[model samples]
Target: MDERFNVELEQLLQDRGRDFLSLSGVCKVMPSALRARLGLKSNSRVGEVQKALQPHMGRNLEIRKAGRSLCLVRRGEKDEMLLRSVQARPGKSPKTLRNSLPFTAAEFLRLTNSLLKEGRLRVELNARCEPLLFAVSPEGPPTLQPQPLALAPVPDAEAEKAVLRAAFQELEQGRIFVRICDLRRRLGWSREAFDSALARLRRERTVQLHSGDVSAMTQEELQDSFVDENGFRMLSLTWTEAR
Candidate 1:
């Protein structure tokens, strides 16, 4: 149905502390109706019901049926919601304080990396490598304060080569634009050094500037290029138009 209805249904299940909600109970429908909600065809097998609920159930939920009763187990609903809030509004924001958004399992575990230091966001390989959930532990969030990144150290030649290879690959694909600043950060190079290297590459005709609509660019654009010792450097390498 509509997104609102879906959200309402999910919230309703959580608020009610339900572990298992039968399709019949949700819509006053029959076993066949439940099969439809579970995204099953008329000839679909009986086991498809679990697959349908897997996405919304997160990690703390379990659905099981014993005899005639279909039950659910939802553990730590409040904590999981809190973690989701942090992930939606990461970086400096009001969300950094208590209770703006509910944290998802992943964000909560990340915030408190102590007890769950070994835990990580769960990656679902079958679902396009999408993130599914976060692991939790008995301990709480870590106390490490974030730090601003200053110039750490110059990247060695091996790292620089890796950066150039990746950038060149992106440039050739022409599907996704690669910015110079991204290359610099990925390589841990200073602005001047990055620009100088890029300029040298441009002179070799290995890359091209696909766009220059400065005002239309986003924050992702601001870090696109770098300044060299001689001031801002221009891309020297370029792909020639086919004759």
Candidate 2:
């Protein structure tokens, strides 16, 4: 209900490029408890959200809201942390790497792309951050490899479905694992358009891609997965009430 608090917290994360925070973890040390922080019980006034977040705003940190839950993140961490945390095997979810490091969703993608280009790593995602698996290639460092075959363009309906699915995902978690290349082919959008749309979604907290190396996913299966709890940003205690 505190617009200023939400605005400021959003700005702080934007400046630092942080995208998530663990409210449950933060509430333990965040002055008042979670009840007070969320205006649920009144241990802290509505203004407290602002007060608590002000000190930590920017400087590579901020708070974000997904429904009624929150998470924490710091963006000052290095790209090497990403590489170091990943298991030295394939089929590992990049989400594990995200949990081990302080990188944001954007930073995760940028770092992954860079490492992939440099022949240092590869990614295989399951569409969401959680339960993701990642592996470091022992192929003697990362290398840029050309696409073996060009995929024919897909229909706009397919791309629209992808985008719509991504939007719903943002409402829960802040990230989505989408195939940008495939999205482009389906939507008939230029590379720039795809990037721009992604940027807008990120700013609005509508959706995010944690890794560019999204593995191929079947549409029907992904759609089904989105409705399940695991597809959302993270687990929510309150959300269980909806069930």
Ten residues in a row with the worst lDDT in model 2?
Answer: 234-243
Give each model's whole-structure lDDT. 0.41, 0.41
Scored by lDDT, model 2 comes in at 0.41
List TM-score per model, in order.
0.28, 0.31
Q: List candidate 1 segments past 4 Å from native.
A: 1-159, 167-177, 227-243
Model 2 lDDT per residue over 1-243, tens place: 456545544554355333444444333333244335455332333245445654545555555433233445444445664665453223334543444344557877798878778766654332232233344457565332322111222246446435544333434453333433333333323333444544444455544444321122322112212112234421111111111
lDDT of 1 by residue, 1-243 (tens): 344334544665666444334432433222455446557654433345445554555455545442233333344654444344333222222222232223344554455443224352221221122222233322665221221122222356545544566544554455445555444444433345556666665555555544343332222224335444456533223343221
Evaluate model 2: give its TM-score.
0.31
Model 1 lDDT at residue 13: 60
